[model samples]
Target: MLTLPNILTLSRIVTVPLLAALLWWPGWATGYLLGFVVYSLMGVTDYFDGYLARAQGAVSRLGIFLDPIADKIMVAAVILILCAAGNDRFPPLIAEVHVIAAMIILLREITVSGLREFLAGLQVSMPVSQLAKWKTTLQIVALGTLILAGGFREQVWMHDLGLATLWASAILTLVTGWDYLRVGLKHMD
Candidate 1:
């Protein structure tokens, strides 16, 4: 139950509040820089946790359950933080039309989670699609780059690039999310 991979996953869950604290003050560029480093480390650990689990044949039910939960928690936290206002240099990522994008991602996550739970209860497995993986990758890059943009306030380009990625991810989110829903609906009744 307490394998190294699980420990790493648990560490990410444990440290999210600290991550939120770092982002609490938007004016704190130093804090944002540190948050970026911490966020990057969390991403690295996310990779290794699964890699080590598979390589060592240490995968467990606990690991399978916690991994996605940790990921969602981290992503949600960062999104909510970035959506709030504070720094003049770094505006809210979810401002104006971006709110629709952000809401799309959030809504998809909730919908898919509920669908997964329903399928699980029916003893049906809904394997992740390849495009879903791409959506996850785009989302991580979008959020990470946005956080990094906060650290580099002078680099408006970073913010713009981050916004670009955010919209791209949102587009992917809609596609993958609808795919999941289509499959899920088939098993509904």
Candidate 2:
């Protein structure tokens, strides 16, 4: 259904490409700033979509299905774009070692998605956990901060803070990922 919540989620899925394009050029500081603004707006929409759905009792099956997909698509696009944007630069948006962190996050996302799909077939719902929520928050902040850092290239601290949170979020990602995998395996043959 095209409820307001569903509409908000749809907006996020559609905006991801624009977010990617904005981050395509790392040196375009102004573009990065604008990208940060866009990213923040997307995040706001993400929160409201779910909240409005719950508050209004308008949580349709379509909304549930599309919500996480939108989130994964957004995160994946941002990570891939940021990693790609910095490959040739001395200090890329996502540094060389930090790419490992990004990879970990990406791998977990794919693996969990598959696990969730398998569980869905069994009529089992794997709701997001508290720890996973924390991980998601950190991941968002890490990625957003990195984008913000791009706009203020001279503020090396922003980049450093971003990297620090990236690593922290990656660690949390592994923990929560394992938790999901453990739950998933229990349903396996």
Candidate 3:
């Protein structure tokens, strides 16, 4: 439907490769800064696309389908890139105590996605809950902070704060994920 909201969503999907490329070189601090800027812009567009779609009554099947896919792709790419970078202090974002949290978040995404697909096939909609919104917020903050930490490696606090947020995000992920799974199970045979 080439609507403005749809256009915004597609733009996010299109530019993710550029984001990935920017994060590919671990030593490129300036590149991580640029990547952070790009990632923040993507997050902004994500908010507006959904808002405009709702406000203008322009919601479409295409937008609905692409929105979560774009989000998952963005989140997955950032996580993988950050985890692989392995700085002097953190080594990997998923190292030590952060590993379980990261794994939980990643696994929940996969589980919820599959659950959504299964429910969709049954004509059952799994609406986003308020807690799920918090989960998304925590994820954005966690990843964005981690990216900024990459840009400013000397700031141990930045990475620490990012790790804190990552754990919080993981906690919320478990809660919201179980909620979704519970709803999904009810729709199953």
Candidate 4:
């Protein structure tokens, strides 16, 4: 149960609070830079955990279960922290329409989670689609770029780019979320 891959996944879950703390101050460029580093490291761990698990043939039920949970937790924490920190300061980090994108991502996460559970209860496995994988990639780039933007506050371009990807991810989120719901509904009464 305690394989290295699983440990790596667990480490990401363990590191969420520290990431949140580092991003707590929107005005603190130093903190944001460090937060970007921590966030990057977490992303590294996320990749290696699965790579090592497959390479070593150590994949377990625990690993399968915890991986997505760790990802969601990390994403949610970043979104919430960014929103809160932005509000705490003057102009919001997630700002106006970007907040809607964030909300879409969050809502889709929760809805998909519930739908996944429902499908699992019916023993109907709903595999992630390729488009969903693209959405996940967009989400990673979007959030990471946004965090990096916090580090480089003067770089309006970074923020703009981040928001662009964010909106893109949200659109994909809607499509993928609907796909999951459609599949889940097939199993329902």
Q: Spell out the clash pairs found in candidate 4.
A: none
Positional deviation of residue 112's Cα in model 4 after best superposition, in angstroms: 0.8
lDDT of 3 by residue, 1-189 (tens): 999999999999998999989887766789889999999999999999999999999999999999999998998888888878665544654567687788888899999999999888888899999999899999999999988887887898998999999999999999999999988888777
lDDT of 4 by residue, 31-82 (tens): 8899999999999999999999999999999999999999999999999988
Query: Model 2: per-residue lDDT, tens digit, 53-166?
Result: 999999999999999999999999998988888635525788678899999999999999999999999999999999999999999999999999999999999999999999
Question: TM-score for model 3?
Answer: 0.95
Question: Model 4 lDDT vs. the true structure?
Answer: 0.92
Please give, for residues 1-189, the per-residue lDDT of candidate 1 as tens digits: 999999999999998999899988887888889999999999999999999999999999999999999999998889888888566665665577887777888889999999999999999899889999899899999989988888887898998898899999999999999999999899876
Ranking by lDDT: 2, 4, 1, 3
Computed on alpha carbons, the lDDT of every model, listed in order, comes to 0.89, 0.93, 0.89, 0.92
Off by over 4 Å in 1: 87-90
TM-score of each: 0.96, 0.97, 0.95, 0.97
Report how far off residue 189 is in candidate 1 (Å). 2.0
